[model samples]
Target: MKKIVVIALLIVITGYVFAAGKSEAGAGGAVEIKFAHYLAESHPAHDAALAFAKAVNERTDGIVTVTIFPNSMLGNSQELVEQTTNGALDLVIPTEPAIAKYVKKFNMVGAPFAFKDYAATDKLFAGDFIKWVTPDLEDVGLKYLARWEYGFRNYTTSVHQINTPADMQGLKIRTPPDFVNSATVKALGGVSQTIAFTELPMALKQGVVDGQENPIATILTNKMYETQKYLSMVNYTYNSTHLLMNIDKFKSLSAKQQKIILEEAEKAGLAMQKAVREKEADQIKELEAQGMEVAYPDTKPFITAAAPVYEELKAQVGEADFDYYMDLLGKSRR
Candidate 1:
């Protein structure tokens, strides 16, 4: 699918979406930051990004502003990240595994079963963990603003119960291009295919893949229920994401502008997160109403199947860093 660059589109949306004041964008006028992400408007992630935009505009008195494009309206996650690194797009929030392609060690952050829940994720984010991961991104030309939760990832399918690795034998499963996710499917004996988001709906309807795995919010927001049946709350991975900006462009910004931007982004992320946690049951109920069967498979079996994923991550990020992550996680549970 073609990328949806929101910077140009943001201009078009000014009169319609932003109302009267937005046409002032220019070389030295109000700086319009184009933010790109891959979540539908209805999803909490989009809600947070949009909230950040509104907050930035409000907090900065429009001198420093943000315009958000959700659901890859500014292109897919990869394209957005490239744009951000090139300073063409101001920001992009990418799933850590996708960002892993650029920042190798970051792949460890979202390995299958990485964090138990939001609390664990919050603790990791609040500490020095991300600082340790930042050095890896400097060489890649992108600045890691902060680590954000991608929410808890669950497994879903159109067929049988996936309580054990054997149950998934030979099933055609669609997964994101993350190595850990791909490996998990392979470990469980499924024929894993890395499919792009825009093409997933068609792929499902055409039976190109028997099932896919994603958070409840993603599955529902993407309307996968129309194409799939079984929803397994595997909680296999709490796929965290990173908000990134161009290294040079971020360095060029005034300290005040940078402060306002990141602080507002954090505010937006927190709001979005709280909303998702609150709406979890609602999303689950909607899926059931749509005739999709939802089940919380005994998670131990799924966790057991995911054991090797961590070791693989360790191999990528190094044992020291992997051990440090687990150590922090262990502390967080207490």
Candidate 2:
């Protein structure tokens, strides 16, 4: 009787230990990936993320599933990247400048007027840019997946219309905490004020800054039109959001799983680009209807004024990498 009781107790203890040791992969070995981004749910990026998640699930045959956290639910852009780097999160979508803080060469992407148009952007991305930058990301525990569109940034002001570089003088413009952004504003004669995106709407509403720059969709979706009275289609700099995954988390997947993720990421990124392009005209029209004045100043003067920014950036990002990027841009031009 004593032996029988001891055997039963041991069996219970063994079962409990096994249960506690089970991985978060859950039953049948399905892996759950956590993805977070700071874009609003109404934005095209959110839709693209959902499509990517769905495609991955189907392609992987349920072996992998993705869960999304939108609108800074997890944290702001920089915070999200930090979480991903530390393996606290599996994936994140952050702006190129945010990644530039970790990888200096990325600042080349912010070169004023680097891209002539959408076709040029397509060629740049389709070429060796990703291959060139992947190793830097891997060194920092990140895997570059794809580049999603953030569209060309434009200026919106409450105090004055920005028709030329001279018009920008002394105007306080809110910019992201990025050197290139601040440099661009300062080079064009505006006083650059650094602010986080999560705090921008309130900053604009409270008149913390006289004006700000963003894609039209952001202005419309975030209702910046309420606080801003003028919109200038400067198209000064094009920005893209990069999708990245934790390096270890990505490597742990099977070869086939890795292939599926890469393929789906590109497809979803294309979808996001398409959506933004399709909606841009209507978004501007809607903003106009909301009582905001729109300006289509000839960008030639603005581009010329921004020339010094390129040299400044080259000095910061190193001439070698900057020239390499310029070579790629030259090849990308049609």
Candidate 3:
């Protein structure tokens, strides 16, 4: 009788332990998310991303973990987008122009003189503008999380300084893979050469191109100053990068997890933007200290030269939407 009672108690304890183990497994399993970007680790955006991943992990109680692959370790912008679309990548951040190739609505952001300054551009993006165009991304299997800044695109060269459109005449300028960028270079009377970002330094060093255009932060972070002798504070174009996720992968997350990710991304993006704003002047000064000549030329001529691109892209974005964007800019300027 004593032996039978002991055996029964042992069986009951064993069953309870098994049930607890199953419950723990159901609650403690982690969801891993892979995020990729093409910026170096020193970039503000990269730092912000790591912070965001940490926030998400903590907020979700370690149920969601984000692993970031920076400096194009995953692939270039185009390949990253493709991978995200196919569900191989969970998240990706690509510049507006790169994404503009898939959704033309983004092209409006890259138009010359799109906004008076970074503040105005930031306002427009932080407002209803992004919501209006986000629907277009769904068709491409992407879900827009937030708009992050890539800073203002400036001109740099090993040959001569650019003060006006004529200054760029016959200059071979390396541009990103964007039609608007190429158009802007052409409008400035320079020949546009599209080169891979990874190969830009070699292109500039080898004299394959006389100059290139990118944000101040990008030029500094990439150490293009070593290859390029001059920096022009053209502020010719505003480069906006968008944080995105695979729609299916996002939808697969629990409602709570999705909310945390979106909220965290926005927080991270705003922090990164602030850091860029703070560092822009400092970075330019650092470039000068590094032996690159800096110039602030009259931008009126470049702005006037770039006017045609707006007209050309207006037809593509439709007159109504184009007008809407202008109206937004007008409000922001005031």
Candidate 4:
């Protein structure tokens, strides 16, 4: 009787351990990835993230699954990246400038007036840029997956129209809490007030800052147009959100699973890029209809005023890397 009881206890204990392992590993021992980003559900990136998750799961036949947390549900942009780095999270999509905090060389991507248009961006992002940054990302326990569109940063002001660099002087501008953005605004002669995106609406309403800069889609979706009276299409800097995964988490996946994830990420990124570019004009129009004045300022003076920002980037990233990046940018230009 004693032997039988011991045997029964052993079997039950073994079963419980097996069940717990299976639960942690997900259904059928599938690998589950948690992806988080700051974009709201209305943004195209969120839709693309959902589609990416769906396609990845289908392609892998339940061998892998991705769950997305949008609208900073996990944390803000900077915090999300930190969590992914420490392996507390599996994946995150953060703006390029945000990544520069971890890898300083990434600051080159945010150099003011670096990209002329979408064609230039498409060429660079599709080329060796990813390869160049891969090792650096790995150093910080991140694997760069793909580049998705954020859009060209433009200025919107409640104080006055920003037709020239001179107009930006002394105007308090709310910028993302990143060095590149703050430097860009300061170089353009505006006082940079770094603010978290989640708190921006209240800041604008409270007159904490006179104006802000963001992509048209973001402005429209976030209702920033309600706070600001003017939109200036200076296109000072082009921005992209990079999909990153924890290196250890990515390495734990089988080769086939990794390949499938990469392919789906690229496809989803391209989809997002296409959606953003196609809707930008309509988004700007919507902002105008919301009682905002739109202006296509002569960007030459603005570009010239932004030259100091490039110098600062060069100082931060070193001369050789900066030159190499510039060469890549030049070659990418159509």
Candidate 5:
């Protein structure tokens, strides 16, 4: 299966390159880049990506143009990252957890209760954290361009209201295929089932899982509220989205082009963060209008329950790196 997938990927890449060359020749020598993400068009990430594309084209004066594939038109999160790593895709903005599969230190941020809140997260982003993570990425043929927000992940369940870790006992909850998410469910005493984001609605509708957790944007955009009965604001984790590109492809670009790409990516990320912050309350209200009950549960219990995850992940990522990150996260809160 791996060999078959590689062969298929090569074929796709070869075909795209050839077709892209011909199309660009016909389009008066404009370079074309493909950007992909797995989110609905209504998603803030999608809107931000479109803005990035527009800004790039305008700044480059039509010398370059970006074609975006939202909702995983090219592939799921894992496949997209792999494609970017192999230079088959030009860019992708995947969740930090997905990126953690390639770069282990990313797991620190993906771990449950990693950052105190968005402000702390921003402080880490503004500091030397990206520099610290760059070597791991460059070693794997990728480059981190910008950080976008995925907002705080909260619980939504059809089974019951979750005010404390005890309430989650024996409940089956869906999580993405990531260790932090699974460990979080285990710590809260729930059964963890890895489900693709695209299939989560059906999974919840058919009772395959009793509930799931995601940011409010995802819950509202994907209409998960339609299937889930309650939204619990436990703020168990913060979801972070990062723009990544093939390091080789980025280096191949002219210095000016590379600068434009990086600048536009940062702008897009900030735009996304602003949009998410401004729209969250409205999104929750929309979920309520869709018949979902929203609750702001006391999060101390959930935070206490997830404490072990920090030690477990720190051991996995190495004590030195873990301590460095903790120091950064700790200072960020102040």
Candidate 6:
């Protein structure tokens, strides 16, 4: 009788232990979030986004998981931005102009010749500017968690070597829908039109557009080299992406969980920045190998053409604010 009682108690305790373990494991094993961007899997930006997801998952011990939707799997950049604003998407990494729809101030970063180079670009993301930008993201239902550079913009075309502002005149250029970018092309005396990135190759082949600008990493990864004959090295504006999370979705996590996720996200962005700098030489080499006539153009003329934008920015935001952004621009050069 004593043996029977002991056996029954042992079985009951074992069952209870299994049940508790299962509950805990099931409850804390996964937190799924969507991260959207419009770059191919092989693109540096995509790789960086993946690195961010990997870093976050590792740091959080599988408690937080990100589902990266690259190649515009979720939708186009514009559609993704809309989803993010309406809370249909959890996170998105969009270009500077995309954010201008909601937070116009953020667009200041994209001014022509905005950053002198990568080091200055890093300063803008690291200092007081980030603090000011974060709240603006929240105002639009998104939270800016991190900023990462995608390198400087490089121009490419099949018919011409665009070494001067005059070379761009009368050229049909594919540009982002943002007025600022179109304004940029206008200032250069080019005809600017918005084209979806996925359809850009067709546009080029069909002569619907003359050329476009992108990072060398992007021009190579998308195989734009096949359609583009000229790769002009116009180190114009440095394009940076904002890693934004939907505020409501982020608020669903426990405070401790949120803190961990944010810390890990910063790590992911830093890793991406490192990847960009390190892989740049290889990326450029790949483009040149793929039959691209990579021209090292003097950007002085292009920079001069964009001088009018400073006056336009002043009109919209007043001289004081415009000057403030330009001050930031100068810092980027240093």
Q: 1-334, model 5: which lDDT tens digit per residue?
A: 9999999999999999987665543344667888999999999999999999999999877878899999978888988999999989999998878888898888888778766667778887888889999999999999889998899898899988898899999999999988888899999999999998888889999999999989999989998977899999877888789999999877766667788999999999999999998999999999999999988888778888988998888877889999998887877777
For model 3, residues 9-50, the per-residue Cα lDDT tens digits are 999999998766544323446688999999889888799899
Task: Judging by lDDT against the true structure, name the best candidate.
Answer: 2
For residues 32-142, could you state the per-residue lDDT of candidate 6 as single tens digits?
888888888987677777777887677667767889889988888778988998888888888877887777776677778876678778877766677766787788798
**Candidate 6: which stretches are off by over 4 Å?**
1-30, 316-320, 330-334
What TM-score would candidate 3 get against the native? 0.89
Tens-place lDDT digits, model 1, residues 1-334 = 1246666676677657544344333335578777888888888787777777787788767787777778888787777877787778888889877777777766766677767777877887677767867877777788777555567877677777677778789999998877888888887788999898878899999999999988888889889989888887877777766778778766766666678777876676667677877888899999999988877777777778778877788888778877887886676667
When summed lDDT is taken over every stretch of 10 residues in candidate 2, the lowest stretch is 19-28
**Candidate 5 vs candidate 6, lDDT winner:** 5
Q: Please identify which of the two predictions, 1 or 3, would achieve the higher TM-score against the true structure.
A: 3
Stretches of candidate 3 exceeding 4 Å from the true structure: 1-28
Where does model 4 exceed 4 Å of error? 1-28
Q: Write the per-residue lDDT of candidate 2 for residues 1-334, one digit (tens) a residue.
A: 9999999999999998766434323333678899999989999999999999999999877768999999999888888998999999999988888898888888888788787677778899898988999999999999999898988899999998999999999999999888788999999999999988899999999999999998888888888999999999988888889899999998877667888899999999999999998999999999999999999999999899999999998888898999999999888884
TM agreement with the true structure for every prediction: 0.87, 0.90, 0.89, 0.90, 0.90, 0.87
- The reply for model 1, stretches above 4 Å from the true place, is 1-27
Residue 322 of model 2, lDDT score: 90
Q: Tell me the lDDT of candidate 3.
A: 0.86
Candidate 3: the clashing residue pairs are: none
Question: Which RMSD does model 4 reach against the true structure?
Answer: 5.9
Residue 134 CA error for candidate 5 (Å)?
A: 0.7
Model 4, residue 36: distance off in Å is 0.5
Give Cα distance to truth, residue 244, candidate 3, Å: 0.6
Candidate 5 residue pairs that clash:
none
